[model samples]
Target: MFNNNKLALAIFLAVSGASLSGCGGGGGSSSNNNTTSSEPTWTAGVFEPSSEFKDQCALPRTGNDPYNNNQPYPDTAGSEFTEKMWLRSWSDETYLWYDEIEDNNPDNFSSVAAYFDQLKTFERTDSGAYKDQFHFTRPTEEYFQESQSGVVSGYGINWAFISNVPPRELRVAYLEDDSPAANVGLQRGDTILMVDDISIDTNTQQGVNILNEALFGPTAGDSHNFVIRSNDGTEKSFTLVAGNIAQTPVQNVDTLTTENGTKVGYMQFNSFLSIAQPELISAVNKFKANNIDELVIDLRYNGGGLLALSSQLAYMVAGPANTSDYFYYQTIENDKQPKSDPYPFIDFEIDYSNFEATNTSLPDLNLSTVYILSTDNTCSASEALINGLKGIDTEVVLIGGKTCGKPYGFTPTHNCATTYYSIQLTGVNYKGFGEYSDGLVPSPSPQFAADVKGCELDDDFNHQLGDNDEALLSAALYHIENNTCPIVVESSSAKQPSFTSQAIQETGLPLTIKQPLYKNNMDLTRPLPAKEGNNE
Candidate 1:
């Protein structure tokens, strides 16, 4: 589902009983037009087919789309009510938890986005977290730019927010090679003190807006100044200009010789983008050539991308002998459509840039067991890889904290130039298991299928990733050699310099920087099941 080529997607969609929507450019209409006494009223449960109101935009776009071969815009003149109704029907039809959603009157909502936001089920998981936390929307332009192009306008730095209170703590998590942050010598664990003269710990909403915009804002060539404190208590300043950064999905591929003379392959895999196909193939081939006795993949920061790429990696690890069956089975809304075909473990190399098979047999390590370095940031397709391999009895030893719980995915359906993502499908492994909504954890004796055997270690930012001394990677190596998890104790005297200011609250919003909903969710690009004689 992570293809970047639009022409290829168009051909597939044409034959797959679906038509592409929202390819043109236009913003949402400002006409709220609240329901008046003379206006038509609707019952809560009563609905129409989403196609009835599809592309009926309040402010229809003009002119042909330059991105889509100058195709005419599909939008037609309508009201916000029509747009909202389209979203409501779409949710009722496609949402995985449609029964749990509260049917609200579309006329009561003011805008399409507001109504779309409330369309998701408000149910929570047993862990007290929202069951459907991945619901969101983005302009079609923005979605395609990031998803299709795999290019983002940023400083090439992934920030880790330890806290987000008055005494907020932000640190440099990692950087892309030749990135603005890496070019300026910013290393992991360096605490950010100020951004463009605004203190990171500032309590004012205005200050928060400025800080967020300067750090996460999406605009090329936008310059911002930053002040950071190093791990050794050294203060430094830098000016970074944002640019289009194409991420190096795979990095730090190396074969490490353990103290016991066992060869282990280690690589820091950042994302599952299309560009990852060739890189991953190269890395696996190197490992295979080196005759690595074991493999350790650093996925602590990989928020996942394409499912195909994930399946490809799994095939390389397990090989065709073990992966001759379905990788996973996708289940959609009950009775809405027929059961989908199982995702097979891909064995041939794919030019994911165009979603085509290269016809070349993938190099396999034939490893029965693999060590995966993970954290809360590891999610979606990354988790799918773990579940897929485990389905075939492959031992996936997870090292580090629990993964970000996400077993659900959706097909990005666009309408009115806005790409809306709602939970539509729940994928399970060949073993018919996918209930890890609370997240997969590491325990000596895992009670549930989601739990794996490994150690729960803290992410050590003191050392560079893929380094021999790094915490998570080191734990994996030690586990391989000793056949047991090691007990790691931290030095008491080592403390990061905190902001010299008063704290507003005892805690902060969250530990990690908030990523876009797309980054954390799986995308389904294969043909979805449609009703008989109906194309979705």
Candidate 2:
């Protein structure tokens, strides 16, 4: 039964339902868990569209989700009480549009933790059962708090290891403006040689995990010593106190004139938190002032967050070119209503920082086309941004590798002590295209990829992301010059495929970076108001 209203979700728990299990970040779409959905063929000669996935969700029946008092929850046992509460919430609210809940039973599971573990095998993820439902209760209150406000506790360093290989060299990717790393003058390109006198690299497999723990310990405010090597090869050792640092979703922004005299704007927006809307507006405003000839958004590592901001960014990029066009469409399993609903370009002036009720006219760049930098980590709302732009016929030139392939989205529901995010809806562009379960690959074939300009380039570790000559950024600049890809390289010096990125095998290792932020607060059922004033 496909039902997701708040009341229905509650009644179901009194039934069970679900989203993606992700690593290093929190997202409803989960990461690196796509199992190829086998396109099922029907003997009846019925033509099935890409939207339906039967072969992909075929998982060997493990067990079904318990909806009733199938398991005796001793009232005396606090664990049972907690487990029951969780199970009920899962049953009540999980979005079963992709895969039905009762399909797998959890009767054999002995404990609530074990039941929860066994229960997520049924998400419809379209990639097959590889999409394990990412439903977990927080053991601590901090996680619950972070869900609502999008705030996190950590040293606020966005560092990436030099490589996944042992004897790894840790480098600072970028730092939050007010993070401890920034306060200590740790700039990008600085390498960490030691953590509290312990070497940053290890000779064994556990080396990375061990180094990670030291860098990101269990508690904030923990002081650790470090020796960092500057870009000039100068080594300086200093002590850094890891404390609660506010994460800045808008990581980097710059506007510059390229060597060819083309005005280009560059931004590396990592997440789409509510705070990002204003920051994004600020970035676009700068580009507007500069009259950028081309814009580059480096989302090579972004796992995505809010869709509202993603929509706004799309609108900002496409500007007047797509003023009346639809950014994307929402589709549900139940067909009682229309086939799909259009979410038009909302260019409202909104104070996303405060989640204000009122709306204002959003600033627009009005560029007819855009160049985006991506990798396997670019996902959900990020993918939506790419598709949304494509929907309006904006020229989308993709540089770097393929994206995380997630048109899936979710709205978080809070229970006793945990927040459950189930994949309630999937998005399609204005053309009614949605299923990129295998991800949108950049190629000449419009059937297999997004129909726009693009190149498959790797990231350059030697240069900064927004640098004029960076691997992905360079391709964008080249596209502006020759309108084609630069000669593809064997690989970038910064391309460390075997490193700790999820692009490597999902080894379930702890990461020094903060977990992903995923949420979309837009009221999907309602259509956006028409553009104000100037119809032109």
Candidate 3:
């Protein structure tokens, strides 16, 4: 969701110096004795079109046509004209609409124009502010504004800075199948060196801009050269032609496994889009059919999607009755009471009874443990799933890197123009006993660097760890085989408080609390704490 305060701030910056005018002026040119002055010709008030004006404005114009002329004015020209109109409308009353403005007259044009100019400036500044706030890069000609569905498809060309091991490189974390980069063989984890001819030394806005310029433009189909460093440390150059690429948000069941003679099911959730529910259900059912003893959910690169889906997945894994208990939510009270001596401050408890009553009901798998693989790419809806699962007493052993730390979500709203935009606001904080605003920390497991030289003789060596490495998987299996769930006895003084499930529902807070699991495993506690050679 877009932040309203941020938008307001942008507007303030954009129109800081603008002046306000009020009421009535002559519409026609009038002679003034003062050589330096001329009569104003517009009026003030909100620009509400008259029925006649609406009829004319609503009609679609064709072939480079402008409303005032046969040819459409350039962007720069139109902006200048709009500013002039705003000034005139603010000064003259005649410019104000008869029905819209309360104090209508000829000289109100200047006020109206001033307001309009301020509005435009506000819009421009807001756009800039939005980009900066989200660390988003401006889209170039090669970049296309994808439909909402496209974003869900796991193919959205959105890029975010992520830390990689050993010389952290600004890599392509997500690539849609239909995107030009994907078409040209760009894959997640591919280290980008140069776009067009510009080198990417820093993962800053400027670096992203260079990428946009190289990959997107009016001449989209034109070929451009890219220098990249593959995961295996080999550098290669490729000439790619830019084009529209389809994104796939969800990936179906890839494989299933059994650990310690116990059936272990594995499925990679690539995205949290609308289509993910059915796919997930099918995967889970298949695992059940296979009598899987454990499940490994890979969300290392899942960037997140619909909140409904996250809840739905939680219900499927942890059961309906437990959903509310497993997640945290709160309501914001805008009204503030004035401070006084011994002023009483009350924080109201939010009731989540309605949520529990409406969502789908399902039984918790109640597996011994759920192995969740995560990385910096896991965000939003993905984080929600993790938070929700942990809230319900489900054993989730996080493996891999710390999450991207995106707890907020957004809902889109449309304005007078059909052009819709999203407002990003903090809705709920999913504190599951462990307050996780810092980031989702993973548990330590076995770590290994591939010994490629040992398997070079095999032709399939290149494809073995082509996509995801097996180190994390191997570690999970190792623990399952050799280690029992580590139990820690707390001192009597350190005894924790436990609340009933009902209490959790009423308060929107989890009952059970525990310290960070770092004591059991150090490596998994905090992103393998930057080693001298590690790049991530």
Candidate 4:
């Protein structure tokens, strides 16, 4: 339950000359006092309940809400202190590793967002990476704009960092069709030599910041010049203006025939966005109609989106018999309310517009195995698909690099016009295994049952995705026919810049430059019907 008090009762009551009855969480008399001692104080390791500060804002937005059909913003009068206190209490109660957090005094920090950033655990993974790398926040309206409308301001390029460190190599992994980048003839494997005038390989901090902004942080109608070296080693300059681009979640849907006459269904899935629901359904329907022997989902660049979409995709891959059991079980902190039931494989369609269930039964392929083209970019919900399928005894042959190890998720929490996404839950499969924090590797000799079976090969950028000749796809095809991974031959093309696995692993923050806060996540905010019984 949420302490949702109207703004009128909390803020307008003062102007209306009405007696306040503790409406805005102790804002009646104590909050109205000008005395310094009356202000809320913070003691190290001590916290007041978050509800006491919920909806309290220092600079609350007034007037009609442009994002919500001219509705009033649900913000009340408070201070920055109350906002920080809310974050501390909420995070303490719900953060998956609340006990591991260092309870620093919130007053020590200058800004609310800055203080909220320090609340996560400073622990490391086995590979020395931050245990909670997914902690971040976004402007509430910006987060909803992308999640709901699937529109973003960009050049429509998914930039791949072969190396984010100096001698930094940035290349175009893929492009949304009809976008500025595609319209300018930018193709996959085209390395960006320069953004504006800053060289992509610049080692200076100022240059890196400039490069990051030029490539990732652009507004609509912004123009910049780029020097690109194509796969054929031809360099050219082009001016691209950023615009509002709607993402194409699913693309290159086709059925490929191997030399042995085995039909394989392949589709490049970029994001698990709400806009992807119908596209995914239709792709599966086509695959089912074609009676494809195997399915290959290219998620090398899919950061992740809604969890319900992940469940739906898993169901479609494994079909009813395999998905009758639980798909995933999420565990929250014990201090929070009772946990919900394990999410089962979604069999029916969902109207993502309103997040309501539909009578339309989803299409399924009933395949026992699926080939997933992965990379470190294959994160949260994408990894969920692999783990969920493996839980139900379906084979997930991962070709290419290891997945971004994130079995974590959170319900996006809103406070003071900012939506904070902290790790609230860690999800495990029906087998009770979710410890792949380092990442799920493509191994020929899988050490654990959850370790995927396939080859650890480099991402093939020289060839277009869905082409049978692409390294990852070709490897999947080879494994399908030969029942074993083929020997990986290093490509000699300069477009396929070689980087050590360690370098790639260490480039986590830099790699996420193109992807914003909400892009890489298993958002637990999707509405699902309550199914009876815990499948666990």
For model 2, the stretches where C-alpha displacement exceeds 4 angstroms are 1-93, 97-114, 122-129, 132-150, 161-170, 191-193, 197-210, 228-235, 325-327, 333-340, 351-357, 444-447, 450-452, 491-494, 499-514, 517-536
Candidate 2 lDDT by residue in tens digits, 1-536: 11111110000000133222222211112112333332122221122342232112212112331322244321221223233334534443444342344322223344445545544334445555245333444422454344335566666666565454444556776677787778878887788887766666554456656666767543576777889888788999888877766667776688868777989899998766665667888888888888888888987767676565676678788875565635444445333234543455656654433333233777888888788888766777778888877777787888877776666654554332344445556667877777775566665334555434588766565676677777778888888888877786484354544433463444433334334323222113222333334333
C-alpha lDDT of candidate 2 relative to the true structure: 0.57
Task: Report the CA-based lDDT of candidate 1 relative to the real structure.
Answer: 0.74
Q: Give TM-scores for every candidate, taking all chains together and pairing residue i with residue i.
A: 0.87, 0.72, 0.50, 0.88
Clashes of 1: 0
Instruction: Give the alpha carbon lDDT tens digit for every residue of 1-536 in model 4.
Output: 11111100000000001121221332222232222233466665667888987888877878877766788888888777778788889988888889877666555566777778777887899888779888888888777788778888899998887767766778888999899999989999898899888788776667777888889988899999999899899999999999999999999999999999999999999988888889999999899889899899999988887787888888888888776645444444445656655666777777666556566789899889999999888898888888878877788899988888888887787787998888877778878778888889999989975479989988888899988899899999999999899986666643433345476556532423656346787766534432223121
Q: Each prediction's Cα RMSD?
A: 7.4, 11.6, 18.5, 8.0
> Residue 97 deviation, candidate 1, in Å?
0.5
Error of 4 at 3 (Å): 27
Give each model's whole-structure lDDT: 0.74, 0.57, 0.39, 0.77
Score candidate 3 by lDDT.
Answer: 0.39
Most lDDT-accurate candidate: 4
